[model samples]
Target: MTWADSLRTAWAGMWSSKLRALLTMLGVIIGVAAVITLVAIGNGASQAVASRIETLGTNVLFVTPGPGTPFTTRQVAYIRDNTPVARVVVPLLNSGGQLSVGTSTLPAPVVGTTPGYQALGAIHLAAGRFLAPADITFNRDAVVLGANVSQALFGAGNPVGAHVSLLGQRFTVVGVLQPVGQGPGVSQDNSVFIPLPVAQFLLSTQNLSAVLVGASSPTAASQAQDLLTNLYTNRFGSASSVTVASEDQVLATLSATRATFTNLLAGTALISLVVGGIGIMNIMLVSVTERTREIGVRRAVGAVPEDVVLQFLLEAMVMSLTGGALGVGVGLVLVHLAPLILKTPAVFTPSAVVLAFVFSTLVGLVFGMYPAVKASHLHPIDALRHSG
Candidate 1:
């Protein structure tokens, strides 16, 4: 039989058993869809992290206390004065507890930071103003609320100039930060900001939890990181006293880790494809047995062994390809809509789509081979005598 004739016959056979064909294709559809959706989610998370890092400035480096004691306020001043590339150095004193506004309470990550912390972190006031140098110098009991914190505390009411109790002290809300979504560093939306000295006094410690440093440029940031590392090593008499990292370095590390995790997830999802292939193989084997007499008649008339094999192979591929097409549609929809459900972005790469389709096709070809060969190898007389 001609290839076209074999193709039509294969398609007709599949069409005749529409329900079975659909049932058999379900495996491939599910496998492909799962792989695409998982990969898209992984890619989206990576993108979110990268974008957050970028928004925070690659020229920024986070310096945290590593081993021994935390950095002292004087030590922070010394680093600012000595570090060549360091342009802005902000000391951070964290209050790790809940804040109360009337009867409402929420765990707002309270930070005591310098005036430069606002600009360095791209923080803008939605209402009122940030901590001025006077506030920091005088150690005033003024506080700024993050967007979410303000909403949770005051609902629709403006929080500026309102009082919120923190660590048994009443702090007047001087400002409310603009809504900045969760990002790489501390979440600005769920935090409370106060002057550095007030935070130290309230938290009752002069030791700094961390220091935010901004360099003149990306290159300068790297220089600043190295210089800070060396300076801390000398001052603390050990390399373990401080942890310094530029945003770029952190981004690279995070990207590599995400890539590894993505690969692992994709590999696990691919196992479903293998299972789908096995399903196809088993179903096709049964198909060959059921159609033995039909195959016998074809071969007895004029169909060559290759013709018989091709017919069965075509049927298998068409089913898988159809499944793959459907899977792609379902996956694309999930990628577009899942972000809303997951509250994270979902990025669909062309490479991912192509890979899924190609893998599904390969599955069909690989799994269909055995059944096609078996059907083709059967003698016409034997096949004719065989019952379904």
Candidate 2:
């Protein structure tokens, strides 16, 4: 028989038991859909984290003191004055406190930093201005509200010039920052900013939490890291006194970690495909037993063993391919809706779609082989005598 004739025969045989055919295809359908959905979610999470890292700028370096002692303003000043490669060095002191504006009260992180922090290009003001040099020098009771904090406390109205209480200390709102979203080390939208001196007095700590250093370029950032590392090592008389890392280094580590997790998730999803293939094998074996008499009649009517194998194999492939197509549709729909459900973006990858479809087709071929061979090997007289 021609390929077209064989395909027609196979199609007819599958339709003869429509419900059984559908049931056989169900496993493959679920497997493909699961693979696509899981991969999309994994890719989306990776992209989200990468974007957050990128927002911190590739030319910035983060410096933190080690376990023995915390950083001081004098050390921060020394670095700023001596490091030529560093464009801006900002000392930061972080604390958590409850903020109250009238009846509205919310708990959020409060960051204390100098005016040089603005030079990092991470902060953008929506209204008024960032902390000034005078604010830090005089320990002014002024604060800048983050986007979310502003929205929660003042709603649509202007927050600048409004007075708010932080940790029970009253302060005037000097500015409101634009929405900056979450990034590595800080959630810019959820925190408040104050002068370093004010934060030190309020929090009762003269030691710094961290220092942000901006460089002219990525090359400069590397040089600055080396310089800061040496400076801290010598000052504390130990190499382990401080930790310095460039943005690129941090991004690489985070991206690698994310990729590993994504791969693990994809591997877990692949097991479903294997299970589906086994299910196909089981059903095909049963099909060969039930169609033994039919196979005998076909072989008696000039059909060779090869023709019988081809027919059975084609039927299995058709079911799998059709199921894969339907699975792709279901996966696409779920991928689009994933953002609403997961509260994060879901990226549909073309490679994932192709991989799933191809894997399903391979499953059909591999699983169908044993059953097809069994059906073809039967003797005509014996098959005819066997009960249906």
Candidate 3:
């Protein structure tokens, strides 16, 4: 028989047993859908994590006093729009500072930070808060509590007038900062924010240890790096004093994390596909037995062995392929809709769609092959002798 004739006969057989075809296809569909949905969701989550990190601050960079470099609050100025790019520098002063309300004493991350830290840390005041121009102006002994700190030490107890001990000195709580999570999330609460100048004076270590610099946005973070590097090189005459890390670095780390999850998901989905393929093979084998007499008659009437085999093969392939297609649709829907159910946007990717379709076709071809080969090897005499 011509290939067209074989194709026609195969399709006719599949169409005749619509219910069986549908059942077989279901397995293929599920396998394909599983792969698509898992990968898409993984990628989406990766991107989401990156975005959240970037939202913490822009063009943010850190500096650590290098080996042999003593950290002191130096005369260097904080980098600002007005500070010549090559001339600006800030000393990093990380110290232990004490904050007390009434009799409650809480020691927190005392950063001897330049004024720019106010913007870079996204520090906001919950009450009479944030070091005002006057406070920073007068070099006042004042303090601000991170959101978590305010809740614990004050909790609407009015911390504005509260006295806090910094190191050994007494300072008044000037501002109660709205909670800003610790940088890159080291903690959620209880941080003491003092002006960089105040930190330097009290800590009695006047060499800039590290500078926290902010960029306008995540994408422009790299630009800020160049500015910082050039500034450091010009002032320190070396690159050892500063290092610039963009939000992209955190995103890359998160991507690596997602890869681990993807591997796990892929392994599970592969097992499902294998199980589904075995089921298809089993069903197709039974079909061949039931249609033995029919196969013999077709062969006797001029249908070649190849044609007989093609017919059975086509039925299995069609079922698996249909199932694969349906699975893809279901999976894509699930992945895309997940974020919505969780009150977030779904990340749709075209690559995922193509991959899903390709996987489905593979399932059909792989599971359909054995049945086709078996049907093709059948002898007309033996088939005719068999009772359906």
Query: Evaluated with lDDT, which candidate comes out highest?
Result: 2
**lDDT score at residue 16, model 3, on the 0-100 scale:** 82
Clashes per candidate (backbone, < 3 Å): 0, 0, 18
All candidates' lDDT scores? 0.82, 0.83, 0.65
Model 1 TM-score relative to the real fold: 0.64
**Model 1 regions lying over 4 Å from their true place:** 55-58, 63-86, 90-211, 216-243
Off by over 4 Å in 3: 54-118, 121-248, 342-345
Q: List model 1 lDDT by residue over 245-335, tens digit each.
A: 8766767777797888678767776788888888889999999999999989999898899999999999999888888899888889888
Better of 1 and 2 by TM-score: 1
Give residue 119's lDDT in candidate 3 (0 to 100): 54
List all candidate RMSDs to the true structure.
7.4, 7.6, 12.2
- Cα deviation at 374, candidate 2, in Å, is 1.8
- Model 2: ten consecutive residues of lowest lDDT: 47-56
Q: How many clashing residue pairs are found in candidate 3?
A: 18
Where model 2 places Cα greater than 4 Å from the true spot, the runs are 55-58, 62-118, 121-212, 216-220, 223-244
Pairs of colliding residues, candidate 1 = none
